[model samples]
Target: MDLHYTDAQNAFRQEVRTWLAGNVPAKRLPSFDTEEGFEAHRAWERKLKEGNWGMVTWPKEYGGRGCDLIEWLIFEEEYFAANAPGRVSQNGIFLLGPTLMEYGTDAQKARYLPAMASGDEIWAQAWSEPGAGSDMAAIRTKAVREGDTYVINGQKIWSSRAVFADWCFGLFRTDPDSARHKGLSMILLPLNSPGVTIRPIAQLDGDPGFAEIFFDDVRVPSENLLGPEHGGWGVAMATAGFERGLMLRSPARFQRTAEKLLALYRENEDTASPATRAAVTQAWMDAQAYCYSTYMTASKLMNGGAVGPETSCNKVFWSELDRAMHRAALSLSGAAAELDAPWLDGYMFSLAGPIYAGANEIQRNIVAERVLGMPRG
Candidate 1:
């Protein structure tokens, strides 16, 4: 792989660095899981949109600067470096927006993409029903077609950001005769629909970072459907690819964490155990490896190659690396790590890295079965 950044890439990095230096909030916003914090994050997203920096890979008509994937990666590097407010609109901008771009109708694109870019309609994911957490094939939510609308009825649990989101997208069974991965359709619906109910679930810190959603014969316009009916399994997998493989966890995030880990180690090396120092060194190396892996993936995509099994490998690598990095930071922090600081917050959030996108066990299975060509039991 080419290790050198082109002159244009360097110039773009400087541009992003300069803009972020000027624009990032001086004080950190509250956690976006809270009501006030949610609005605060949305405002930050709007500020990013105004700067034409929200999801830079999006087309220009969608309020982006039409940057390529590498530029998006560079932007992410600068963003986390600035200690910018966390992306409250990520469920839309990172996960659903890419899916919509691939499978949405012209009208759907015009309707959702711009609002998503502007953070006017923040989105939550409505996957992981009571039965189908990792086994998406087990999803029981159904959306029955009724003329110009689909009447949806089911329960969705562990929906991230649902407590405050304006909309959601997920795979619902439209064909009663079908089960497992088959006969599913991807649908988008407003959170305030007449027959919908939302109950928030608190995180370790008591913030409602997730919610449970109940659909009681909720009706969404048939036009809201994305991709082919009964073919949503593929569409959802495509979305999963983006989630597990790309946007949900970016390399810059881990790189920043690694830098913090090194700084922590340097400050506490006198008292830190020998093992902790070794782990810190390993974390930095892993972060660099992840950054390179992601760069290779971006290069492939930029050159018209699809992200496949290797991205699953990337997911496993970075997620575990994030947890390890946080562990090292916590160890370096000694007793102070117990306090409510960035290290504590990051450590808590890192605990979920292996679970989000998809559970690491399942991802390892994918690596074994798909990448290594090992036979499945």
Candidate 2:
């Protein structure tokens, strides 16, 4: 892979940099978990839509600039460098948007993509249930078909952004007798539908970063079914690949964190222990390694390679790298780490890295069985 960007790519970077410098908020926005913060972030999304920077890789008709993955990486790099507001519509634009493009029909794409890109509809992920956390095949949520609709009944816990999201996409058991990974369908439903209840689940920061959703015979049109009925396991897995792989956790995010960690080390270099210094160096190197690896993956994807079990390796690396970077930052900060809001909050959030987007343990299992061709224990 070429280490240097083409002239056009450099120009694109400058364009993004200029726009962000002019439009990014002068002050950081609040967390999107709160009502005020949520709307603030929504407004930010709308602003991005107006600039046609919402989802750069999407087609123009879907409110995007029609760029490729490499360009998308450039946008992310600039986005983090600008310190822009967190994307409140990440569930829709990053995870579901790609899934819809692949699995959705023309009509489905026409109906959802534009709205998702414009932030007219924010989406939540409703995959984890009380019984099925990492073991998604253990899902008990039922969606019984009746004429033109599917009657949904079950509960999903730890649903990210459900508290303020407009819609959700999840896998439900379509076949009553089906067990494990079989007989499932990915379904999209509005959060405001009758019999849909959302109870906020507060994080350690006392914000509703996630929620528990209860569906009591909620009826949704059969058109809301994402892919082929009873073939949703594959559709859901594609979305998980996005979550665990490239889109959700961009390499630029960790790069920025690593940059901050290095700066923190330099500030206290005189007092920093040898282990602390070593950790900081390791974090920076890991961040660069992730960035380069993602570039290679992107190039392969552009060349028609697909995201596969190898994404599990990417997931494990970036997630653990995020945690390690934060830990090093805290070590550098010493007692002040508790009072340092950014590092403190980041450290707390990093703790969830291994748990969400399919637990690191589950990801390792995928790597062993699927990528490494190891037999199941």
Candidate 3:
């Protein structure tokens, strides 16, 4: 893979850098977990759409620049460098958007992509249930077909962004007689529908970053079904690939964090021990490695290779790297770490990185069994 950027790519980087410099908020917006913060972030999404930076890799018909994955990486680097506001519609744009592009009907694309790009409607993931988190095939939510509509009845827990999101996409049991991964379907539904109840689930910071959703005979049109009926296992796996792979956690994010970590280490260099210095250096190296790996993956994808179980390896590496970097930052801060809100908050959030997007343990299993051709026993 070529490490050098072309003249056009350099120009694209300059364009992104210039736009972010002029448009990023001078002060950071509030945490998006709050109602006010949610709206504020939504407005930011609109601004990104106006700039045609909402999801650059998406086709132009969906409010994007029709850029490739490499350009998307460049945009992300400039965005995080500008310290731009977090994407409140990430659940839609990152996880669901790519899935829609791959599996959604033309009508579904026309109905959802524009609104999703503009943040007119925010989406939440409703995949995890009380009994099904990492083992998503164990889902029990039922969606009984009723002529032109589906009557959904079940519960989903730890649904990120559901408390204030306008819509959700999830897996449900379309055939009650079928067991495990079979007879399941993916469905999209409006959160405000009657019989749908959302109860906020507070994080350690006391913010409602997640929610428990109860569906009591909630009805949605048959058109809301994504992909083929009872064929959602494959569809959901595709979505999970996006979540665990490139879109959900871009390398630029970790690279930026690593930059901050090096800065933090410098601030304490006089007191830093050899071990601390080594840890900091290792973190920076890991970040660079991840960035290069991602570029390789993007290049392969551009050549028509598909994202597959190997993303599980990427998931485990980045999540652990994030946690390690944050932990180093906290250690450097010493007693003042708790008082440093940004680092503290980041550290807390990083703890969940290994768990979400499928647990690191499960990811390791995929890597061992699928990527390495190891036995499953």
**lDDT for each of the candidates?**
0.90, 0.93, 0.93
Tell me each candidate's TM-score. Answer: 0.98, 0.99, 0.99
Against the hidden true structure, what lDDT does model 2 obtain?
A: 0.93
lDDT of 2 by residue, 43-112 (tens): 9898899889999999998888999899999999999988898899999999999999999999999999
lDDT of 3: 0.93
| Location of the lowest summed lDDT over 10 successive residues in candidate 2 | 331-340
| Candidate 1 Cα misplacement greater than 4 A, ranges | none
Q: Candidate 1 residues 206-245, lDDT tens each?
A: 8999999999999999998999999999999899999988
* C-alpha root-mean-square deviation, candidate 1: 1.1
Runs in model 3 deviating more than 4 A are none
lDDT tens per residue, model 3, 1-377: 57899999999999999999989999889999999999999999999989988889889998888999999999999999999999999999998899999999999998999899999999999999999998998999999999989999999999999999999999999998999999999999999999999999999889999999999989999999999999999999999898888889899999999999999999999987888789899999999999998999899999999888998988899999999999999889889987948999999999999999889999999999999999987
